[model samples]
Target: MLAAIVGRPNVGKSTLFNRLTGTRQAIVDDESGVTRDRVYGEAEWEGRTIPLVDTGGYVPRSDDPFERAIREQAETALADADVILFVVDVTTGLTDVDQEIAQVLRTADAPVMVLANKADNQEREWAASEFYQLGLGEVYPVSGTTKRGVDEMMSALVEALPEETDEETPDRTRISLVGKPNAGKSSLVNATLGFDRAIVTETPGTTRDAVHSVVRYEDQELLLIDTAGMRKTSKTEGVEYYASVRSEQTIRDGDVCILVLDATEEIHKQDLSVLTTVNEHKKGMVIAVNKWDLVPKDGGTMDQFTKYLRQYLGTLDHVPLVYTSAVTKQRVYDLLDTALEVAEKRAQRVQTSDLNDVVQAALRKKHPPSMSSGAFVKIKYATQVRTAPPVFVFFANHPEGVRDSYKRYLEGEIREAFGYDGVPLTLVFKEK
Candidate 1:
């Protein structure tokens, strides 16, 4: 079941959304209208994860383009929602906008629950009674920040849903193409599939949602995800802001992500930040330096550019990068080949005996560092605990004493021994 949190600007709707979904998907700011698109996340009640959408504040009329987009997004979310959480600020009392919104929802088929948010104190709780004049239904006082009255709100909301929703995972290799706006990600998607799956536009933020398609290459079927170009939150407005949120979901859920970068534009700060997010998710990745046709080339230009990229990758420098131009189809097949190789590496697992041998060699070369007290950290065997972004557990007497430098060393040794390249490696130190 889908429930949308709807209200006017600065009424704590985004705060309420975070409380319900237990996700930082929606950005909460003191400034009004920070949330401009319908951001979707799950809310857990009892044992079920209920789907929830955080929408922009609804306005009856607006001349500004962003505000108009917000109103349209809210209306679309309201139309699809099974329940509407009409959040209002108790401290500010009821306003004309609240009444106007209530009037529109009054005729809607979905049930409306007026949430009097920010009722953290007795006086504010009493102020909630003013919303009864809106005539929507019983007013439920809530504190989005404090999380007071949230449980009761969920209890009521669960009973209001039409039925319990269970989403099934589809069987396919999911690949997400992500990058900054106007970086030619959509064009890359078209080149890979040999057809236009997403609209390639000159304007930034043309693709509002993550476009999905099923394609085949070498008899292997995979899900292709072309997502919106992410930008700084401060620069994103209205629909573009929420589009980036959806792209994050695509990265987390995808098995492999091909990060597209424009060669002409060079790498930006936002590109590195997005890569950090992908690495955090521990997904297999390949960097596609797109629009290589635009870069003026010399005998050593490509070599210098590769070094520049490696500097930015830092600890993630192990990830493979391929220079390509979707317009000219330069190295396009190489991108897919490397991406598949990355996915294979993510799923590769080393046997326990091999892991222990590699760990022993690494330890013998450079012993464990001791704590400030000079008590030596014991060296022990290791095991591959899992795969799909392979995780290795290293047993030690003092897990806390193992520094970051040592961990990086172990990761390098494991990669050299097992050939799990182009994927993030997780090393966990624990006392056994």
Candidate 2:
């Protein structure tokens, strides 16, 4: 079941969302309009998990472009939700904005339940009774900060939801398209899906949410997540700051990430930051040089650009790169194919015998450097401990004596023998 939390700005909708979902996924702030997009999370109550959407502040008669966009997002959530959580502030009595929002919820098809938030004291809880004049439904006095009265609200909410059904969720390879602002991440998504799956604008940070779309390519089902452009935290504020946080969460949830770069502009530090984030999470990645149609190219342009990127992507040179043009649909499908290949490589498992053979050969080629204490280091055997970001554990007589340089040598030999392209490898050394 899907439930949407909607109300005017700073009515504690995000606070309530975080409280129920048991996660700090939605950013809470004193500033109004902090949440400009629909943030999705799951709420577990009475052994049942209900999907929740926290929307931006709903402004009825706003002329601001952002406010209008926020209203549209809220309306979309309202249209699809099974239940509506209309939040109101009890500390401050009924207001004109609250009245306007209540009017709209009365006409909604879903059951509307008013949440009188900030009712920490008996006085404030008494003030919550005034909201009944809106005539939406039962007014539950709750405090999102203290989580008081939330259980009663959720218990009622779960009973109000439709009966559960046993439906199977399809297995999908989640591919996250992430990059700096206006790097053509959304355009790539629209092109790959052959439709406007995401709102594309010339303006930077147009997509403030991690929008998800499912598509079937060949025999594989893929979940494409188009995320907001990541900017340096020092320069970001308010909504954009939270947008960056959402993008980081998307990276952790994704199976493979496609780092989109504008071919016309030189790679920036922000782009490298995104790359490092994906690497640090140990997620499979593919580098996409977008807007190839706009770039002036010669016989060696691609080769020179590849070399330039390699310099910046020192250790990440193994990641696959595909030059694409969303406008002309040039190599757009190829990018998807490369991402799928990276996903497969991430899930690849190696046999114990094959793994040990490579480790033995690497040790014979170059012995591990000795420690300052001159303790002898002898590696006994190696085994893969995990897949989907393959991790190998090596047993050694003195694991602490293995040098970083020798570790790199062993990693190189393993990669040479068994390809793990576009996937991070974790090597653990243990004393036998």
Candidate 3:
């Protein structure tokens, strides 16, 4: 399922997005219209997973030349969504632009869910009720700070989803190190390989096209893709555009994407935008704070980095974060270790007997809820249907009512039984 989070400018959409994705994919600021492009992520609602999209904020009243382009982008996201999460500021009530957006969603033939955001308190939660007049069914009040109502909203979302299943697959893990110009992507790549195989240049965007090399570690061959630095879209012209396009294409092709960030400069909108693209591609991701040696060592940098990451890249929480100084080779190999661990987890496959046994044990520990029609939900069998990113299919009596929360419990059990570190798990509920 593909869910697009859309709303007017500065309604905390990016903040909520970071909370959900556990990433800093989108840049968050007091300024509106900062996010000029669409950002994407793969989000799992419990174990009923799906892709998520964070589009440029819709500034309905702006006269800026780019305003029209942003509107069109938002419209495109709406068109592509299996479901639309319409976010709104509960404290501010409904503005005319909000009404305009609601009207558009009303005409849209897609599944639309209204989210009353920033409802951090009881009063704000009550304030969210006014949005019901938009006619998008019940409004879900969520506080990105507290994470309140997020799980409930996700639970309802998973229940409303149609049945889907995954097929079996072999393990082929490819991890790509990617980032903007001069962000040290190549340095990180070389550090991972522990050799100077990848040429490191002082010039920005030195590495062009996709340079791929296979490195053997612990009996596993890791295909390391060192990509060119992606320039600003406006600066992307001729061969530069070709390089940027190829870099993005390479990111989508990889099983895991490691976004190398510069520690000296403040994280830019461009970096966050690239991250959004990675998440949208549904690739397991890790954010490496590259060039850590340059940081002032004022302390709290790691916490600050994580806080900002969570703030901007909402709703994507499955990614791993690492801090490394690629130039100093400090903790660089650790990043590779983490990447390999993630790759292994992503490529894992569990036996049918093991899966069934897990489900049986889970049910015995905590029973699933009864449906509204009074039928008890029963997971008859479960098995690993796929390996890449480790997708498991559950054969159940009440697939719809299995509940996202319960599915999360099952995934947790599977992880505990078989450690799938650094990888995202996908769970699909289907009838036998």
Put down candidate 1 lDDT per residue, 383-417, tens digits, no spaces. Answer: 88888878989899899999999999999988877
Highest TM-score: give the candidate number.
1
Model 3 bad stretches (over 4 Å): 1-173, 192-204, 216-221, 230-240, 267-282, 298-315, 360-374, 403-409
For each of the candidates, the C-alpha root-mean-square deviation to the true structure, in angstroms, is: 3.8, 6.2, 14.4
**TM-score leaderboard ranking:** 1, 2, 3
Let me know the TM-score candidate 1 reaches against the reference structure.
0.84
lDDT of 2 by residue, 288-353 (tens): 999999998889999999999988898888888999999999999999999998898899889999
Q: Residue 118, candidate 2: how far off, in angstroms?
A: 20
The lDDT ranking, best first, is 2, 1, 3
The best candidate by lDDT is 2
lDDT of each residue in 227-279, candidate 3, tens digit only: 88877875443344446656776777798888888888887888877777776
Q: Model 1 segments beyond 4 Å from truth?
A: 1-6, 13-44, 49-86, 99-114, 121-139, 156-170
